[model samples]
Target: MKPRLLLTLATVLGFSAGTVQADTIGDPVRGEQLFKRDCAACHQLGEGAVNRVGPQLNGVFDRRAGSLASFSYSKGMSRMGADGLTWTLETLDAYLANPRSLVSGTRMSYRGMKEQQDRSALMAYLRTWSDKPQNIPEASPTARPTVPELDPKILAIQGDPAYGEYLSSECTTCHQRDGSDQGIPAITRWPQDDFVAAMHAYKQKLRPHPVMQMMASRLTDEEIASLAAYFAALD
Candidate 1:
């Protein structure tokens, strides 16, 4: 094949692969169910949809935050738009998980959907309503332009397991140390980094577990790192 033709073929294949990956990650049917259950009260979609508690969501993807002329927006959302924030699948997932955390001082109050599968489904369903749905590949081998920002405080902390062990007693009451699978998950044997990330997610209200969000809210970054270290070290 000629070099230009080969290049064209490669581009076409790559685009086809990305589209397939995006379509498969979330089931639109399930996503619609979750939307009605969790988000229908506040938002709407399609032509002639009206904004309620939240803005109408038609043409949401790739649009700047607070860009819509028809609805009232929160100060933080307007600031984000001023800072050049646009909605994409990755951004949408983060916002869906925790609206206030993604954009500090957002007016939206709902805690977030914890089930990743549900979020994926909701995202797929939402794509159909958008004027332009961005199709980001699932776990793309290529680097993404957008990365979720991490809290500097948490990133700076060097964890101490000894200190963490002392702090972990409170966590054990609910999360449980025993290996048995029950209502709550077993908390021990986590990797240090994953544990830290999960704790920070809770603290930042990204995880949407009400009690954990409240509990993590009071913890300092050092404390979270320490607790992560302690839990991670145990069997």
Candidate 2:
């Protein structure tokens, strides 16, 4: 494809793209597997669920962040609840991606889930417990998973690594070149499409990180692709 055409396509996709939504819940069985692998140790759900290390997630959807009267929550989580952080599909996805990013002093130590599919499945599983028509009130349609899938054409862009290297100085300030994560998550060696999609999310303010949003807001589609290329090739 011509360079001009590629740029045009990127611009068109970058601005107009939105998350994919489905009318029905994702696979709860798969979600249950993920939960068992990652969350079950700390939390309990479904019938006979009770507070474990983490609060029981029976009615998690639409609930305040730390509003369970029986649970002792971190001050930061409680503050987030007081500040009106409700658990909806959007907010839940953000929190699952990176808990610390949303609630700085939260006690949940698990690193966030990176795969959008996995998060959506988990959200679906959680939603099943929260929104049973036979038991609870009808759930809002907006509570469905809002997972975004990048356009294949946009992902096909081949960025200039040299330009990416030049632009990467800003990124290296927070993301270490050596791939070691201190407080922030590691960005090195991520898949090119994942990097691009994440930057776009930050640019759109969907990821909810102020610094990332500010940084991504200044990046063009090509610049983002360049950065993704550069980072993916990094050690």
Candidate 3:
């Protein structure tokens, strides 16, 4: 679906957070399927869920955005939480339809799910993991990761750290030289393959951040390899 269509659909659904109903909606079974297909790579749910690329979805209902102490959220998401953005049914619906429309600089890699039914199903599945009055043991069937693997040839590229240092002047503006996460997450000390994969995701527009996409789009393959090498070596 076109980006504009997704944004428009988000608006048309029209469930304001202030007046949202907490009642369960949609089929959980179908929601499970949708979650496995689209969400398993980044988010985990049910009991004992831990942080992955994204925060665990457990207890997300009515939770403030970026509230997890363990997960490193984007500046945008943290700011939203500080401004009282809670994840109610309406807000989730809007976010699912168009993520960037809700949190512009969010690092969530997946493009938003555009179909309303699909979004409803996914949210329903996620809601099963939320805290409830009844003491129910959490259980979620394991699902395989859905992130696409990179080509072996791409992974084999050798990089020059000196060239990477030359390129890194642009990167260090947002990412700290001292490896502390100020507002942006720390990029220093990442493994080369993982760094390459993430940059490729942005370059291919598989990830949703516009600024990242723009930056990655202009870089040649070797430059990305060099940047990965340089960052990986940082103490």
Candidate 4:
């Protein structure tokens, strides 16, 4: 065969292989379990839930972020939608792993799922719900607001020490006094960022413990920061 023809054939074959690999990388049954445990609180399965804490996730597989009606999305989400971002399995997987990092300033208070398997399962489950075709709205012709650049300074510890003590009282129920609790993980001496990330994980349903999720969900980001700083300051 001519060298030029061989190179063309190799490129076509490589592209075909990549397409096949992309199609074969998810498990729906595992995804379903992950979804029920993690996402069911805010999102309904088969259709039409019209905006709860998070927007309805049905048919979210290929949908743009802020296109749903009646849902009050955060400025971050709306900006992403206007930027023409689509949700493919890969994108969904990354987003579910960590919403804030993937798209800074997203209002979905949930932290990213920590485990790779859990993220993959969640993606699979989401794909099943998205089997139907969806018609996404066009982005408005006018410019949308920009997502604020993340300020690392906002993550600094600057709260009333007494309030930190008060917040720690609730956490000790599971986290324990010395940070040693049977059947529950310890949090003493963990880094400030790690502690905040964990609380975010619980709030986001990325780490599935019902009581923890409920408790974490009720805390504002400011409260989460306070609690995290308090715990990090502990010996």
Note the Cα lDDT for every prediction shown. 0.78, 0.84, 0.81, 0.70
* TM-scores of all predicted structures: 0.48, 0.51, 0.47, 0.45
Q: What's the lDDT for candidate 2?
A: 0.84
TM-score ranking from best candidate downward: 2, 1, 3, 4
| lDDT (Cα, tens digit) per residue for candidate 2, span 1-235 | 4656765886888754574434555677798999999999999999999998999999898798999999999999999999999998889989999999999899999999999889888988888888655555455343443343445565566888789999999988998888999998888999999999899899899999999997987777777899888989985
Residue 55 lDDT (model 3): 97
* Model 3 segments more than 4 A misplaced: 1-24, 133-235
**How close is each model in CA RMSD to the real structure?**
19.6, 15.8, 19.5, 22.3
Instruction: Tell me the TM-score of model 2.
Output: 0.51
* Deviating ranges (above 4 Å) for candidate 1: 1-23, 132-235
Model 2 spans with C-alpha error above 4 angstroms: 1-25, 133-138, 142-235
- lDDT tens readout by residue for model 3, 103-183: 889898668898888887887788778866355333221221223234445446698999999999988988897799977
RMSD of 1: 19.6
Clashes of 2: 0
* All candidates in order of lDDT, best leading: 2, 3, 1, 4
Candidate 4 residue lDDT tens string, 1-235: 2545654786887655344312333567887887788777876766555557777777776688788877888788888889987787667768888888777788777877899778766776666566533343331111112222224544454644467679888888767868776988888877877878888899889999888897887766657778767777776
| Residue 48 miss distance in model 3 (angstroms) | 1.3
True-vs-predicted CA distance for residue 220, candidate 2, Å? 28
Between candidates 2 and 3, which one is better according to lDDT? 2
Quickly count the clashes in candidate 4: 3
Off by over 4 Å in 4: 1-23, 132-235
